[model samples]
Target: MAAPLTDAGEFESWLNDRLDSLEVDREVYGVYILGILQEEESDEEKEDALQGILSAFLDEDTMEDVCKQIIKQWTECCSRSAAKRDAEDAEVQAIASMIEKQAQIVVKQKEVSEESKKRKEALLAQYANVTDEEDEAEEEEQTSGNNFTGNDKSLFKNTNVEEVLNRQKQKRDQAREDAQKKKEMDKMQREKDKLAKQDRKEKEKKRTQKGERKR
Candidate 1:
């Protein structure tokens, strides 16, 4: 018997060898042999069946030995073909498993990214709220300082009391400067009014002397 064929290529090669030795039409007899081998039967049964089938088309004396050889070779070829198909199936399963693993990894990465994005947004929102609260507290502190008396030390806990006092001092100094400027302006206006009254009186006295001279 021929050694088992390793793959389809080796099976084809073995089939061609059989055709050459048998001196049979490759297309006709090759197909007939393949069909007989494909039948669900025991090795002896298939061999006997093929021997009987080919005897009508071939020399009876040579057909028995050739049919037996053909059965052995083709059986090995079938066994090898089955093994190859099993190996291809296993390879396809392995590739499918790898693809599934890669897809799972991608899904996990996306989940992690989405979780990180949510955490970042949450942190940003928290920070913004803190900033707004601080701004409002600062505004309240500044406005509350206007009503501050020397007795309220608790109100200055979140603010610098010395800085508020300095601002108040600066405002008082500005008010004093504005009051001084207004007082100076009033004194200048009073001096201008006195000078204009004296000039009007002198003009009236000159007109009275001219009237007496005309009389």
Candidate 2:
């Protein structure tokens, strides 16, 4: 048979004795304490809120001590949570800064590329103008040669002029072919370099992501 419970103090003393004799896991007890202490209420509010429940098994002085311990634990927990939030915010800011730098670099590279394209077009236009002038000069020479006499000396002069024009035409055609080949090679090399650079950037990006994940 169980003993009859009498006064409030006697009942609380019995409850405390029962709680002390219980076989509870330390980890589970810790989790339960943490759950109560981590509430958003202020220290005073939390103490007051738990007063009625704890009074069932704790005396005045013991309950006060328990409230103090809870407040201390709660303050420490809040501090740790705030520190974690600060670290995460700093990491996010660093990533944003890196992305901004990458964007700036891309913009600068695009500007350089546009400038190079413009320069190439300008050079091609200049080369075409020079070729046009040479053609006009060659036509004038042919017209003058046609007005010469049929004598041996004049015939020799006309023959020499035709030979010079033919040699010039052949040289011009060879120069054009060489220029085209060089342009193609330059374009191929640029494409290869571009691919290599892109690959390097991708590798670097992967490494950065891996490092971040590790953190």
Q: What residue runs in model 2 are displaced by over 4 Å at the alpha carbon?
A: 1-38, 141-215
* Model 1 Cα lDDT, one tens digit per residue, 1-215: 33333454665577768777767677777766666666636778777878766787678778877877777777777787878788999999999999999999999999999999999999999999999999999877876776454545455643677788889999999999999999999999989898999999999999999999999
* Deviation in Å, model 2, residue 117 alpha carbon: 1.7
Return the TM-score for each candidate structure: 0.57, 0.47
Spell out the clash pairs found in candidate 2: none
Measured with C-alpha atoms, the lDDT of residue 149 in candidate 1 is 45
Q: Whose lDDT is greatest here?
A: 1
Cα misplacement distance, residue 86 of candidate 1 (Å): 2.6
Q: How does each model score on lDDT?
A: 0.78, 0.68
Candidate 1: clashing pairs of residues: none
Q: Taking the tens digit of each residue's C-alpha lDDT, what string does model 2 give over 63-147?
A: 7776676556456555665676778899999999999999999999999999999999999999999999999888767766765
Question: In terms of TM-score, which candidate is strongest?
Answer: 1
